[model samples]
Target: MITFWMQMRRTIRLLWSLFKDAETRGIAGVTTVLLLSGTLFYAHVEHFTYLDALYFSFTTLTTIGYGDIYPVTAVGKIFTMAYSVIGLGVMGSFLAVVVKKISQFDRRR
Candidate 1:
């Protein structure tokens, strides 16, 4: 338990340092906007609760596609297709930035 907490603390510190970088902040901002837009769209269009919408958005963006919940309407389906493509790209970029930053941080340490 102590080891787990120490690892969590280290991860949080690393994330904070990563967010301080300009490139990471830019990608994070874009990713945040994408996630929020998807969450809001699903909530309004699918009549989902905010929590459900956010879950769907995160799962969709991460390409998890649990299929437990999905878009019912035609517009919702179309939006989801486009959203998946764009969100996946944004997520990929965000991950790449984080990985690069972590590697640099490790090297410095």
Candidate 2:
């Protein structure tokens, strides 16, 4: 448990450091916009609460698809497909930035 906590701390520190970088911040901002837009769309179109919409957006973007929640309407379904494609690309870029930052951190260490 102690080791897990230590690792969590280290990860948090690394993420904080990454956020300090301009490139990382830019990509992260774009990712945030994508997530928020998706959340709003889900909330308005699917009648999901804000929290549920945010949860669905994150899971969909990450390709987790837990199946606890899903779209029933045709418009929702179509929007989801398009959203997934765009979200995945944005997420990929965000992750790539993180990985690059991590590599730089490793090298500095």
Candidate 3:
């Protein structure tokens, strides 16, 4: 089992590595912040549970409107539009990172 000190050291090391990978880190950080804010807004405005809010946020961000939940308020709609525009770039960057990483792995094989 990892001790608390070990975990802290490990976390720090991983964070440092992520910081070194500036493009990946920036994309991930922006995505996380946007998703968190969107989830919080949805939960507060639409009275959704945290899990539901997160799910809805991911679904919407990925452009997979399952029609399970939707925005009724004007603010929510506006936020949705904003999220779509900004989140798509973050998502695209993440996808680029994933593809690049995969290609690197493939080259090693």
Candidate 4:
């Protein structure tokens, strides 16, 4: 029973590590897509689609709110605030990791 438990623990740790790596990559990709889509949305602010609106929200929350597109409604403002609070931390952390990786790469060069 003890040996079985030890094996299970090792397996769990391996699974957790894999999950963490995947989560970090997922966050980074999501952040980049949101930024790109947001920029596109801003460029075509008027008569935008639902996809454009979502893109705008993500970009704005990430603190890259290009003045090219802005919310004109009170509800939109409230939503923006909420989105920013939730999305900023994830985006910021992902950005920090990216920068750190880049700097490390530069050091090796």
TM-scores of the candidates in the order shown: 0.88, 0.87, 0.73, 0.48
Which lDDT tens digits does candidate 3 get at residues 1-109? 5698887876676555555777877788888998999899999998889998999899988989798988889988998889888888889888888567556544755
lDDT of each: 0.94, 0.93, 0.82, 0.64
Q: Write the per-residue lDDT of candidate 4 for residues 1-97, one digit (tens) a residue.
A: 9999987886676545544676567876786676565545444544456677766766576577677666776655665566577578867777676
TM-score leaderboard ranking: 1, 2, 3, 4
Tell me each candidate's RMSD, in Å, in order: 1.9, 2.2, 6.3, 12.4
Candidate ranking (lDDT, best to worst): 1, 2, 3, 4
| Model 2 TM | 0.87
Runs of candidate 1 with Cα error greater than 4 angstroms are 1-9
Q: Alpha carbon lDDT of residue 106, candidate 3? A: 48
TM-score of structure candidate 3? 0.73
User: For residues 1-109, could you state the per-residue lDDT of candidate 2 as single tens digits?
Assistant: 9999999998998989997999989988988999999999999999999999999999999999998999888999999999999998988998898898999887887
**Full-model lDDT, candidate 4:** 0.64
Compute the lDDT for candidate 3.
0.82
Clashes of 3: 0
Candidate 4: 10-residue stretch with minimal lDDT: 38-47
